[model samples]
Target: MIPPAALAIHLSIGQVYAFSVFNLPLSQIIGVTVSAPADWKLTTIGWIFSIAIVFLGLSAAVFGKWLERVGPRKAMFVAALCFSGGFFVSALGVHLHQIWIVYLGYGVLGGIGLGIGYISPVSTLIKWFPDRPGMATGMAIMGFGGGAMIGSPLAVALLDYFSSPISVGVSETFLVMGAIYFSLLMFGVVTVRIPPEGWKPENFVPSSKPGKLITSNHVDADTALKTPQFWLLWVILCVNVTAGIGVLGQASPMIQEMFEGVITAEAAAGFVGLLSLFNLIGRFFWSSLSDKIGRKTVYAIYFGLGLLMYALIPSLGRLDTAILFVIGFGIIMSMYGGGFATIPAYLRDLFGTYQVGAIHGRLLTAWSTAGILGPVLVNYIREIQINAGVDKAEAYTVTMYIMAGLLLIGLVCNYLVKEVDAKHQLFKEKKREGL
Candidate 1:
């Protein structure tokens, strides 16, 4: 039941990842009958998603401790309101043809909902399933990936249903989606519960040694930031995300250009949807694998294997092999999702469960940074290449290599990861708190 509630919240917030479905439609929205001189450029519309992500990181960092204090129930309800309201506000922006209004609504306000909703269920889930923290966090975060699976297709279908010469159907689709998400999220708010203090699963026994890496200490969120371990993990996450998100943001166009007539626009959308499925599955598969191997080892696989796959992408594109291309990119997407799902448990191993949620919140600033860095790097480079008379098929070649380099850097950071220092450990602090 708890997992389901967490899933409900995450599934809705995950819709943000599918924002690209609107990129083409929104760009051409100003003129229903023909091209509008005032139409928004794709690059201009791209910032809306970036702004929301930036805010997602900001709100999570600023309000993470507040979420810990208030508990998931209250935090979740507020998230529901803000997230749903963003849709309505964005609809109005679409109707009026004002991009700034859309930015304010979806980017700033919707982003706040994303931050709160994302972390809301995480801490509670960890507390409920202490024996399998990796598996527990994986389940909730998997919904985020899965949400994109559902959202991308749903958005495409809705646009088809309501589209006409006079309108692209964005306004109506936003209204409908807003209402539907609010109802589903309210179900989560109603169903979620906190575990009683000292609660643990029945028949669960504490690990005898729990290893030197897994501590019996409790670090506050503030104190966690002062430690080097946190910053190392921050670098690890930032680079990992940068390697994947740019590929994801531009997946639709990249595929179309690479394969040209071999893959249609609709087929490209399905391809995006397929990647979501891989992303969703990888969150569960790799995170569960982490339980058998150590989290550090699992991340080592993500960075190392990820580096090779990224380097191979340019060659695969050059060969124009659709089947092999899909398989390769699919594996990369899995590791990308795996990186997100595994990190919370990795944090638990190093920092202990105390303030893990708040710590996780602060750590998400890496995501905000990557959110801007990834797309801008990919898109900007591709644009420069295109303007310089490079073929669209070859434009992404340099971008893929750059992404591979980012993953190599991540491998170094992961290799450097070690247990928190004793001075930073909070065993004494836990005793003071009477725990």
Candidate 2:
């Protein structure tokens, strides 16, 4: 049985990815405390997001062993509280116009919730659907990628309803969002579960070592740190993310800029809606596809195709309704979400499930790095271009070119990867070897 509890974890953890919806609102409110939106710089707002992600990765890694020891049930119960509470407190912060409080509540506390909530489902799902680990994970992680699809539109509606001319009033919006998310997460906490021990699916046995793993068997956190494969995968993830998230972080503004006079404000919001829609759909679409093609090959396609698309963005140069930008960019955004959904299976394939949840946690540091690098790079490049008097349409041209180069480098890395050898599986040999 897949377990009802697992499903809830899927829904709850998935909400973390929806934070992008708050950017404009946060920017509007935060700009007051900091300065004007244009003067405040998106990079400054991006820092709050970066802080949360850094904590998200750190908590996940530091607590991976604790989660392994205690199991997801208790951990997730606490996650519901912290995650929900973070929103409520942030609501207070926003209302008060206290940027630090917003950072503390949403960035720090909510980030902890994000990290723990994110890993909450992996081990349980792995146990329940051992035969189809990739697909099983895809189901849960697919939600994470697509969360913004539902959240974006829903938030916009709520924002539209709640919003007044009073600088997007942080407090009331916080109260509303916090209440709903709190209730929803409570439902998830009630639903999550752990698998029966020593249970394996009928007629199922994982390959002694999957052919695609970077290193065979379970590498301890210590040994995993020492391996070349770990760093290679690390670099691969960094470049991969740097290519996509830079654009995604700027997605709303980017669309607005792309559409300019051609599309109205409502239409640009709709385009952001569409990008998120594609982002959500791609999560399920690409990760599910990876099950057939193998993760490495799927990632190879992500970067290989991503490079070409990014290069073309400069030439496309703001089309009618920004449709061209939307289509091209939306596809790559899905790859970003797909990367998160697929990596757990990738870790399982190489490092073995014996300690995969832990390994996956360590791997998340790459996301933390991306959280910082992506926004900074995008915002910094924009600042430079604006200062140099480049037109809005042309401002992002060099960034597209830089992202293209990054993806091509990632393409080479993905191609270079081969399965980890048995020799590397020396630690916990009995567990991974299944003796």
Candidate 3:
């Protein structure tokens, strides 16, 4: 059996979740390179996040079947290599002052790592913890959310020690981070394995299927895609992701500008780091809570509370960073992290574990889409402000309002989610809700 510690390690090192931490510095580096009569917009840099997500989602969709065929450990090893290697190569790009190289290493190569690593621990965790699929997936996946909390502060320190005006100090930072992540991930690879068969959690049985005839058999990705549940869930994931990412994409500038009175630009880095902490904590706390609260209800809270939080941001003054940062950024980060955790269970609920690994691959298209929408919206709105001569804080207030609207729509989607096979009430008939 895979050691639980190994499973946690496998999931923790995936860079897709933690990559947002690089947005600010990466953007600044790119901004520095722009020449006279040329400009770099916030949206331009935001593309790094979008490109990485797009590639991550795309790789997941393309590689799902292969991953299923090969197994998570082998795939995750590749993930570690690519993720770490990408960072190393990216460090080179930064040192040479080559933006395209940075994009190639960080966006393309790292994206491949992100996609593979993303689904790495999921199936193994589900197989090992059959009785508590949501909790299991959450535990493994929560690491993604937490990575930035660890990565950002660490990256900041590295940059501080190595930073130069001409060169961002991104190289040394990448070298250290790449080494650490690779070593940790290798340890996870050595320890990961599948649980023994027929090993259901004591007294565990899955809920019944709702419709056309739920069977205890596995379904392939193509067949799984035909179900309404698949498409509906695609919508659900897209909306959820869109809501959180808009805020997260611009978190640093937003906070500094929002509370400029109390919080200054220099302090903004720490506050941004703090947002990551909330992001990380929310992943573990909310995902664990979903074990008791039910995925649906937890998401309901994610959206319901999220709407209020986004609405309050612009009005929240810099009176107390402790108060505003905790309340305002906390809900936003949870939604970001929760989207990663809750969706796996949502997929299991609709598609069954038959070919869930593959179906999840397909479903990640939603992430690709959200990646574009979220960063684009943030950057586009900010671009309008920069052109109109608006300051950065004032720039994002409009985006926040738009995100609130999107969350409300996501709230509707959550509301629309009746039990998957509602008409048939398949859950009523079956005892084992196949993890």
Instruction: Record all residue pairs in model 1 with backbone atoms less than 3 Å apart, i.e. clashing.
Output: none
TM-score of 3: 0.80
* Candidate with the larger lDDT of 2 and 3: 2
Ranked by TM-score, the better of candidates 1 and 3 is 1
Regions of candidate 1 where Cα sits further than 4 Å from its true position: 25-30, 383-392, 428-435
Report RMSD (Å) for each prediction in the order shown. Answer: 2.4, 4.1, 5.2
- Model 1 TM-score on a 0 to 1 scale: 0.92
Residue 83 lDDT in model 2?
Answer: 72
Instruction: Give me the displacement of residue 298 in model 1, in angstroms.
Output: 0.2
Q: TM-score rank, highest first?
A: 1, 2, 3
Query: What's the true lDDT of residue 385 in model 2?
Result: 97
Backbone clash total, candidate 1: 0
- What digit string (tens of lDDT, one per residue) describes model 1 on residues 393-433? 99999999999999988999888887888887778556467
lDDT values of the candidates? 0.89, 0.72, 0.71
Segments of candidate 3 deviating more than 4 angstroms = 1-49, 91-99, 157-169, 202-218, 314-325, 382-398, 418-435
Clashing residue pairs, backbone N/CA/C < 3 A, model 2: 5-191, 5-192, 5-193, 146-280
RMSD of 2: 4.1
By TM-score, is 1 or 2 better? 1
Measured by TM-score, how close is model 2 to the native structure? Answer: 0.84
